[model samples]
Target: MNPPTPSKPSPPSSSSYSSPQTLLALINNILSIVLLSSLTIKSFTGRWQVIHSKLTSLGSSLSSLSSSPHWSENPLLQSLLPSLLSTLQRLSSLSDCCSISSFSGGKLLMQSDLDMASNSLSHSLHDLDLLLRSGVLHQSNAIVLSHPGPCSSKDELSFFIRDLFTRLQIGGIECKTKALESLLQLLSDDEKSASLVAKEGNVGYLIHLLDFNNYGQNSIREHATAALSVLASANDESRKCVFEEGGLGPLLRILETGSMVLKERASAAVEAITADPENAWAVSAYGGVAVLIEACRSGSLVTQTHAVGAIRNVANVEDIKNSLAEEGAVPVLIQVLGSGATSSAQEKAASCLAILASSGEYFRALIVQQRGLQRLMHSMQEVSNSDTLEPVLRAISSLSKLDPSARLLSSSTTFIIQLGEFVKHGNVVLQQISASLLASLSISDGNKRAIGGCMGSLVKLMESPKPVGLQESAAEALVSLLTVRSNRKELVRDEKSVMRLVQMLDPKNEAVYSKKFPVMVVAATVGGGSSHGCRKRLLAAGAHHHLQRLAEMKVAGAHKALQRLSGNRIINTILGRTWRE
Candidate 1:
């Protein structure tokens, strides 16, 4: 068979050809050739020298890496070694051609190959540098040796986080992305991890990944943002760090152009960061106020809810409230209130409007002009949970501070009935807000009859050991209601109401409750020709003793109430005691 023409020895298979030891041996051989060979092409000498330097550096890194246990099985090494071997082989071939006396390829082609080879060498060296800097070699060795289980202690977990954080700092895109996924999972599961991240100052790396400009790394950006959201929600320090690292701008950009899911996450992050009122202006500085308003107008329900909350937080900064109003937040928030969104979203929207309205009459007028009052009333009518109802009531309370809003609210019997229910049975907070709302609406005589039904509830609030502000608001509401004669008769009929009013005037209760509103309420009770048996009720409740003490203290309205009581001769005869007029 012609001596079976001996087949040329087959080249080594790629798997064996690119083994870690083989690759390292090839790199060292190429380095020697590039350093020692005399090139015929004078112009190519400098480029070959550059390749020599890179190969020497890469050889040192590979040698150090090879000493790690099972280094050949390391994923990073497995992935990079084959490509690195291929580049080194190409460089070796180019070095040989340049060193030869008889080269066949065009000089330009040869030059082009040299440039490409140098570039390939540089790229390989960069990747190797990343590998060394990433600390993956050390991590891989630890994994192979001990085969560690789940982190059993905070120190172990912390070391793991620091390792992952180091990977985030220097690695290929895929390596960094994997690190981020692991980090996000850790943060979501462990509150302690979030705190650790903040304490270790790794928060800036997380914030740095918020760059939307990173092409093809949308998932990285999203996970980074989600991680930040977890950190912010869990730790206050993380929230402040997020702002300090200029994270708001990237977060807002995501809100503007990111996917719906991304927008939701970004909005949530913004919401958490801006929860600190001090960070409010950072949002405005990044022009995020307008983006948040636009989100309210069009984002998904979750996005809208977080956007509203972030806007509300920003609005807490007194200066940003006007900026929010000017950005047309009023109309969008009104729309959110009237939309079919979740009750939480509507509640936050209401709170945002309440904040804006609190800025001044200008925002209140804007709300009314935009029908926010009607929308809030509608929201109030639709929801029943205290969480939702409280903000709605507060929004109405704030908007109603305007005369027009008060008039509009006073005309709605449903609203008045709702206010009565809240004042009667709602929690102390709702009771206080409702009482304030009633005080605002009580400016109208027509509202007096409708609101007077809450007299018993308002009077009972005065006896609550809660904050004095509630009592003050309730007493103020009662004073307004007492302006009508029938309401005064109603108050006098409830001996408990008269007694609570008298108790409020005591010098002992002075520090606990303001004497001004209670005195006015008592004076209105016994003031006019309609005093009837009300004067006896006051004296019977010892209103004279407390009133006299208050008058001595020069409490406003105390002297007037004492004068009104002293003038009641029938009450004096009934008590069998005479007072000097």
Candidate 2:
């Protein structure tokens, strides 16, 4: 029996396998393979990550090197600017593409680094602008630096500008003076740098350098005043800094006592600082307006130019304007307008005169008494630049609004004719002022006759496709001129004049024409008498249709115009309506 049992067990081994143990071994082999593959993948991923980190580090280093001041100084590095900018732009795009998890909890840090790199590339471009200003970079290379950015990141560069100003203030005198001169030259048109310099309390130091006790050399004074001017005009904050740092007193002293160069710079500084009304009154309180007026009257042309600018800055203050006028600024400005001064200087003088004249009727009369109108008209004819013409026209316009001065404009046929010519000028402001002055001058019969010669031009304006504002102004001048019999006779001669006037009675034109039609009311009454031919011309030009339309709409001026046109007894009888008047 034992032999038989052992034979049975040995036979069972060949027919069947151990299913549980075999399956367990198969699972262990599969798991081992999976583990090996995972380890291989992790190793390659880590290596790739290391390479990526190194590339990012390299990029950061390149970005830093590009921002270095020496980067532009070296011709080799300067040549790489376009390439470096390309790389930075790519890095910026990549930074934006990254997910939050990609930075391993340093997403904010990564974004800040990218922003800094972008700004660094931007600041590097300004090196060429700086070099050009310093005469180190040639004009040909300016195109390379002419990218859209120009040190415009004010908040970022503010710290560096503050440091430069600090070094200029506390460092050695000659070195600081040279540094400041360079800075002023570089930043004269850069509002951001000037603002940063003023914000760091460096404006006080700049002003302090104006004193002879601190920086006695005229060169230093000249540089300091120039720097102050840049800072004072940078912004409202810089203007306040100039005011708070006693810049007004020192600038006034320079105006009163400094040399021509110093006075020129100081006058500009004062003008910039006193743009604020408080600062302007402060300068006036310190007797600066009188000195400014004297400067305008007798200084060198450069000095006079700066002085006139300063006067304009303060001319808004009533007391200052009166003081300037009393000190004979009116005559000086009038003379400058007529003289051979540069167009820029003439503009400033005319602007200042306009401000003074705008202050009161007394000022306007004073300017007229000084022959300002004659001088302005002379200058107007000589100059073709609208920059000069605009202010001169504005001054004439302002003066001509007053009854006393309107008479002055009416007395000069040449002036009236000059204004009528200006109505055809390409400048819209000149057109507006010319038209407005013509309307004002037409209040007098003599001026009406003078403006009547421009009847064709006025009719052309009424038919123009120009702005409704200009069309409205022309209509106003026409209505005023037509009140005079000779002016109406002139309009009747121009075939299109009546039609143009009719075109002006549009429902859309009510706002502009409403104020000018009291004269139209008088014209209708006057038309019934000897102005019958003028009335017939108006009717023959299809004015009856527009007048009827306007009357149905209840426009106040339309009814009178309708009644006047309907006063033709034959036409009235044809329409089967009797004359009511």
Best by lDDT: 1
Per-residue lDDT, model 1, residue 434, is 86
lDDT per prediction? 0.75, 0.63
Question: How do all models score by TM-score?
Answer: 0.82, 0.63
| CA lDDT for candidate 2 | 0.63
| CA error at residue 555 for candidate 2, angstroms | 3.0
Q: Model 2, stretches more than 4 Å misplaced?
A: 1-159, 188-191, 397-408, 442-453, 456-473, 483-500, 506-537, 552-554, 572-581
TM-score of 1: 0.82
- Per-residue lDDT for 1-581 in model 2, tens only? 11111111111221243333332233233323322332323222443343344344444444444345443433323233443334344433333344222444464665565555545544444433332223222212321222124745754345345434534543456656765766675565465655666654357778888887675577778888888877777788877888898888988888888888888888777877777777788866788878888887777888887788888778888777778877777887887887767677899888887787677788888888887877876877788888888888888877776776677667777777777777755477777778777776645677667657776676566555556566667667767676777777777767765555665665555433452342262353236347777766665655676678778878666677677777757876644442232
lDDT of model 2 at position 536:
64
- Backbone clashes, each candidate: 0, 0
User: After best superposition, candidate 2 residue 264: deviation in angstroms?
Assistant: 1.6
